[model samples]
Target: MFTSLYTASAGAIAQQQGLDVTANNAANVSTQGFRPDRASFSDLVHTGVRAGEDAPKTGSGEKLAGTETLYVPAGGLRQTGRKLDYALTDGRQFFAVRTADGIRYTRSGSFAASAATNGRFYLTDAQGGLVLDRQGRTIEVTDEHPARAPGAFTFRNLDGLRKTGDNYFAPTALSGAAATAPDAGLRQGYLEDSGVDLADVMADLIQQERAFQLNTRMVQMSDEVAQTVDNLR
Candidate 1:
């Protein structure tokens, strides 16, 4: 009886996390270069009789392992006709930028020229992070070279990257070192739309809610069974 309670509680927690991921995806439906997250789950320990006895095996519960970014192309590219707006043809590629917390990577290409200081303008992202070029240097759009493009970078293991908000990603040891992608095609006058699909998000939201409710009911029933045993004693 106690094992059932534990299993139900764990299931409820996992479903709650699933709902959160769905909600976040729905909220970012219009965010440019946004990638939707999917929750991953793993079953806990299991117990069974040895030597294939008549007893059946039972699992303790399941837990949310983590969330994975889809990293797939969104609703295609939209023509913004803006010189600074850019889109990468390869969805796995990213633009390298220098942020306050060192170098970071992002898929967003909506950029602007920072205010001129010392007679020079630098390409910056929405959050004013300096954009880097293929040589890992801040890209300077000089009058002589007005069509400068940002650098494209990729990792060996994309699964090792973690989202750092603002559509940026930070690499983990598993991701290996970032490398240049010289052949990464860039569109100068377009932006990639968010990868979230409202219909799919809503469907997941509903399914998780139902699963959560079912787990909650199981917990309630377990408690009632315990109370009945006490009354009998």
Candidate 2:
């Protein structure tokens, strides 16, 4: 009876996490270049089942294994007709930017010209991150100094990159090194939309909520059974 309660509680926790992930995705539906996160689960240990024995298996429960950001492009590109707006033509490439936490990669290209103390203007993103050029240097945007195009970088393992909030991603050892994607052309007057589907996220949220309720009910049932046995004693 205690085992059943533990299993139900574990399942409820997993479903709650799933709900959180789905809600986050829904919240970022309108955010530019926002990638959606997915939750994965793994089953726990099983009892009454040997490695080679054909006995019926009783599983403990499941757990949230991890969450992965889906890199697939969503909502397609939108033509803003603004020169500062840009979008990558392909999926394996990201724009490089210099942030306060060092260099990071992003898919958002909404940029503007920010003036420095030296009266020099440089291309910067919405968060004031300086957009880097192909040479990894800040691109100056002035009449005398023509604005250099932003750099496009590709990782050895795109799936290995870790998201660092604000739609920025950082390199991990598993991601290998960043390489210049010379062929990753940009649409100068376009912006990439967020990688979230509202309808799909809503559906997932509903499913997770239902699963959570069922698990909670199981937990309640287990407690009632224990209480009844105690009363009988």
Candidate 3:
């Protein structure tokens, strides 16, 4: 009976998390360069159940391991006709940028330029991260050479990159090192839209809600069973 209770509790938690992730995806449907997240689950430890002289079998339980970035292909592109706007038709690459802590990466190509105290024009992202090149140096867009393109990088392990806010990602040891993306095919005067699909997100959300209700029913039934036993005593 206790095992059943634990299983039901775990199921409820897992479904709740799935619903939360779905909600986040819906919220970011219009966010540029956004990737949807999916919940990953694993089975928890089980207990053996014996039936009169029969072989023992285990009951089941579950756990939410973690969330994974779907990292699906790039979405449709919209033409902005702006010099700083760039669109990467390929989803397998990232744009490197310099931050206060270190270099971060993103797929968002929206950029702007600002003049530093030294009177040099530096290209930066919308959030003000200085864009970098394959050599990892701040790209300087001088008046004579103002037409600059961003350097792109590709990861060995996509799962090892952690998403930071503002469409940035930090690579971990597990991700190895980021290398220059091959034939990035970056297009100026365009921007890549977010990869979220509203219809799919809504479908997943509805399924998770139903699963949550079922688990809740199980937990309630388990509690009732326990109360009945106490009453009998």
Candidate 4:
């Protein structure tokens, strides 16, 4: 009975996390270059002691393992007709930008022009992070249009990249290093829209709500059963 309560509680917590992730994805459905997130779950540890042949498998409960972002290259290009707008053909690739913390990576090509000390205009993200080039230096452009724009980098392993919020990502220990894909570069005058779909996010929200209710029911049922046993005793 106690095990059942624990299982229900764990499941409830996991469902709550799922709801949070779904809500966030829905909120960013229209955000440029926003990636959708999902909550991942796993069954709790199962214990078994061999009695005669095989012991019955008993599990503690379910748990929220982690959350993952779907970085699929699916969003279509949006023609903003602005010179600062940029987009990448590959979703795995990201433009490098310099933030107060350090250099960060982003997929949102919605850039703004910032005047540098020398009077030359430099590219920056909407939030003012300086855009970077292949050499990891701020990209400077004085001409109306350049033959080649700043290079977007591709990661060896995207799993190791950590989201820093504000549509930026930082490399972690798991990601070996950030490098540029020779073939991938920013497409001028275009921005990539957020890949999240409203329909999908809404469906996921309903599923999570039902799961949460189921878990609550389990907890209630287990408590009632325990109360009955005490009365009989």
Q: Model 4 reaches what TM-score against the true structure?
A: 0.90
Per-residue lDDT value at 17 in model 2: 89
Instruction: Provide the global lDDT of candidate 3 against the true structure.
Output: 0.83
lDDT for each residue of candidate 4 in 26-92, tens digit (9 for 90 to 100): 9998899998887889999987745554678878878889988788865788988888788887888
- Clashing residue pairs in candidate 4 (N, C-alpha, C atoms within 3 angstroms): none
Writing each residue's lDDT as its tens digit, candidate 1 over 134-179 gives 8888877755243468888999999999888888999899998899
- Candidate scoring better on lDDT of 1 and 3: 1
Q: What is the overall TM-score of model 2 with all chains considered together?
A: 0.94
Residue-pair clashes per candidate, as listed? 0, 0, 0, 0
**In model 1, which runs have C-alpha deviations exceeding 4 angstroms?**
49-54, 142-147
C-alpha TM-scores of all predictions? 0.91, 0.94, 0.90, 0.90
| Better by TM-score, candidate 4 or 2 | 2
| Candidate 3 residue lDDT tens string, 1-233 | 77778889989998888888889999989988888888878888755576555667665667788998977688779999878777788787889999886889998888888778898888888878899876777777765243457887889999999988888899999887899985556888889898998999989988989989999899999999999999999
lDDT of 2 at 87: 87
RMSD of each: 2.2, 2.1, 2.3, 2.2
Q: Summarize candidate 2's per-residue lDDT along 1-233 as a digit string, tens digits.
A: 99999999999999898888889899999998888999888998889855657878898888888898888653489999877788887767898999999999998989888898999999899999999987899988875233778888989998799998898999999998889997446778889998898888988888889999999999999999999999999
lDDT of 1: 0.87
C-alpha lDDT score of every prediction, in listed order: 0.87, 0.87, 0.83, 0.85
